[model samples]
Target: MKKIAVVAANGRVANKVITEAVSRGFDVTGFGRKENNTKAQHYVQKDLFDLTSEDLKGFDAVVDAFGAWTEETLPQHSTSLKHLCDILSGTDTRLLIVGGAGSLYVNKEHTATVMEGPDFPDAFKPLASAMGKALGELRERKDVKWTYISPAGDFQADGERTGKYLLGGEELTLNDRGESVISYADYAIAMVDEIEKGNHIQQRISVVRA
Candidate 1:
């Protein structure tokens, strides 16, 4: 991709994504509500909901890193993506999402998701549920060329960047050590790689340390 737009670029994951994408010489623009939170080739102080396809017409891809921190705002996951789908539907611009691992299946049967596992923390259920619903809603749309990538069970914000990762389908992925983890830094590499390669279109994929 020659150009990309990152929503909520000030986020922990998104900031790293911006750095990685820029390092690869892609024209990157960031859109967020907060001004001066992060650096991008171009920064626009716009709400994610305010963005239009017209606003991102020329971008090869747009990354949705929008986060909803509170239980009350959990539905933003679905609504924001729906709004984006509405605008970008039928367009050549691809929509790439930074999703959670909660929805990932725990087995090859694909009947159970990680969020439903007993060891999952009850406190985080609402957020996970919201994200899972968003993914479900996204799946129903055939017009949007969207790719959603869920992180590993342990999505480490300050974890070390190994520059290596393993890719998986619907099931949760584990490394050789049987650990499910990935750093924001390395995940950014996978994200940018997907952007450039245009693989996994209209699919949900997982990435963890190889």
Candidate 2:
């Protein structure tokens, strides 16, 4: 079975990803700040900032579900991600990152408007900006087999997994309602599918329900 390491596996999205990965027969090991009461094959309680690849050795891939983003935390977040990628460089192990939608382009010419709208939250702007920069850095690296997965503009906690979605490259996706949205379950499925197939290497892709 494929052994996968999941970093920052305590969130709702990470939990769903772990569940899907395990259901697909992958040996899922999760690392996070606190131990979740999940039935994952293995769980390791460790802070993302303190753990190294040596701690994650022998895994086929690393799922960075650790949504590390904040204006004040940007420096540490950038350093930690770079460090993890460097440690896993040149190995068969891949890195699958769950990224923010802010880095995606809404149209052929317009960038994603995560922070410009009236409804945008002030608290989330810094984190979204940081994620955009991090995605840029990851796109420039050649040694690390990485894939950045972004969700749709209307991502929420209550959508159902209909087992359907649209895929795009660095471009924002929208549904029939002229909005973009994805369930945590479907997002996890997409990420695991990419991880297992070694798809979308060194690229940023977005997903939304079809």
Candidate 3:
């Protein structure tokens, strides 16, 4: 079985992803800041900043579900990502990030990103900008095996898992209903599929419900 470690495993998306991965028979270890009843093979209580290479040596992949909401904590996005990259710098372990949709381009021409668009909520700009900056730095790293998965515009926490989704490049994806959304459960399917196939390595991909 593949060994997978999910950081921030208690999160809504990460929790569903862990359940999906475990259901598929992957050996998963959930890492969190404190005691958590996560559905995984094992649980580790540690801070993201304190993770070392030796502690994560055998995992096939590490899912980064880290998020920062407040203004002061927003910069932690870049810091946390860089810290993970440093630890897994030379190893073969893949870093699968649950990324923000804000950074996704609004069109194929790459005219403007969602964060740059006028309709984006002002409340979310700081968070999106921070994640975008981290993504920018992530693209510069050639040593680490990373795949950033950006969910659709409406990342519904209460959304259902229909086991179907469409994958796209950097542009935002809109369905026939003119909706850009994907549930945490369905996104997990796409994430695990990428883990199994290893296609689109070192790339940023988006997922929207089919």
Candidate 4:
């Protein structure tokens, strides 16, 4: 059984990912600030602010599902992502991260630019932009096997897992409806599947409902 470690397991996507991983017979471990109420038997309660490389040993893969929306939290998020990269550097373990859609491309001439438009939230622009930069940096690194998965633009709270999705590389992918959307459950499934198969390494990909 492959051992998978998920950071920020309390979030909606992480929770579903953990559940799907567990169901698939993977030995799942969760690292987060608070104890997750899910059925994951191995839960490590630790603040990401205090986490070190030493705390992340013996895992085949690490899924970073951490997210933040405030300027104060951007530094922590960036630091944690770098720390995870550092820990997995030179190791065979993979880092699967939940990335933002704002950085994705909408067309050949325009990118799904965030923080530059009027509708972009002033408070969240910094955080989103920071995440985009962090992901870009991770792509340049050669030591760790990292894959960033960005959800579609229509991501929301409740959606059913149809076990159907479209996958694409750095270029943003959309469904037949001309919108990008995937349920938390299906997103979790895709993350685990990528981890197990080591697909799309060192690249950022997007998933949307088909």
Candidate 5:
């Protein structure tokens, strides 16, 4: 069985991803601020800033479901990512980040990202902007295998797993109703699928319902 490490494993998205990965027979180690409430083989309660490469060694891949909930802690996103990259530099473990959709282009021209558009919620800009900065740093690294997975504009936790979704490039995807949306469950499916397939390498990919 493939061994995987999941950071922030108690978060909604990470919880779903952990469930999916475990269901697929993968051996998983979950790390969270508190005791992991998931069904993984092992659970480690530790701060992301405290994680050392030794703690993450031996996993086939690491899924970063880490996020900042307040403006005061937004910088942790970038800091933690850098720490992970620095420690995993020469290792074979792949890093898969659950990213924000705000960084995705709203049009094919790529002149503007969704976060800069008029429709983006002002209240969420700080969070989106922080995520954008972190993603920018990830794109510049070439030492370790990293893939950033951005969900659609409407990523929700309560939606069902329809077992269907569409993958896009840097562009934000829209459905027949012209809505960009995806359930956390389906997003987890895509994430675990990518973990197993390794189709995307050092790239930013987006997901939405077909």
Candidate 6:
């Protein structure tokens, strides 16, 4: 079985990703600030900044689900990816980032990003912009294979898993209700599917419910 490691494994989305990967029979390990209730083969509680290259060499892929909205931790999003790239350089392991939708285009012409629009909430800007910056960091790295998955603007924590979703490029996708939305469960499905298929290498992809 392919081995995968999930960082920030205690979060809601990470939990669903772990569950989905486990259901697919992948050998899974989890890393987080504290032990979480998970069925992974192993779990490591450590600060993400403290991780070394040797600590990550065992996994076939690393899912970076690390998230933060605070002023102190937000910058870590870029630094964490940088650290991982430095360590995973020249290795075959892939880095799959759980990205934000802020950077996605609000229009079909790709003229403006979601964060640039008037409707986007002010409270969410910091986290969304930080995630966008992290994606920028990933884009500059040449030695690492990375994929960033951006969910819909209305990413719901209580959404259901129908094992169904649609993939999009940098443009935002909206449902019949004209709202961009996705469930965490379905997002996890797309993530593990990408992990197995590896169809989106060194690219940014988006997901929304079908």
lDDT, residue 27, candidate 4: 94
Residue pairs clashing, model 1:
none
Off by over 4 Å in 3: none
Candidate 1 has an lDDT of: 0.93
lDDT of 6 by residue, 108-208 (tens): 78879999899989998998888888898899888888999999989999998888888998899886677688999999999999999998889999999
Q: Write the per-residue lDDT of candidate 2 for residues 1-210, one digit (tens) a residue.
A: 999988888888888889899999999999889966665788988888788768878998998876655456666556767877888888878898888876677567755455555667877778777877777788778998888899987777778988878887777777788878888888888888888788788888888888
TM-score of 4: 0.90
Clashes of each: 0, 0, 0, 0, 0, 0
The C-alpha stretches of model 4 lying farther than 4 A from their native spots are 109-124
TM-score pick, better of 2 and 6 = 6
Candidate 1: which stretches are off by over 4 Å?
Answer: none
Candidate 3, residue 164: how far the Cα is off, in Å:
0.5
Per-prediction CA RMSD (Å): 0.9, 2.1, 0.9, 2.1, 0.9, 1.2
Candidate 1: tens digits of C-alpha lDDT, residues 122-169: 988999999999999999999999999999999999999899999988
lDDT of 3 by residue, 170-193 (tens): 999988888899998999999999
Model 3 quality (TM-score)? 0.98
Clashing pairs in 6: none
Full-model lDDT for every candidate: 0.93, 0.81, 0.93, 0.80, 0.93, 0.90
Which residue ranges in model 2 land beyond 4 Å of their true spot?
A: 69-71, 109-121
Query: For every model shown, what is its TM-score relative to the native structure?
Result: 0.98, 0.90, 0.98, 0.90, 0.97, 0.96
Model 5 clash count equals 0
lDDT of 5: 0.93
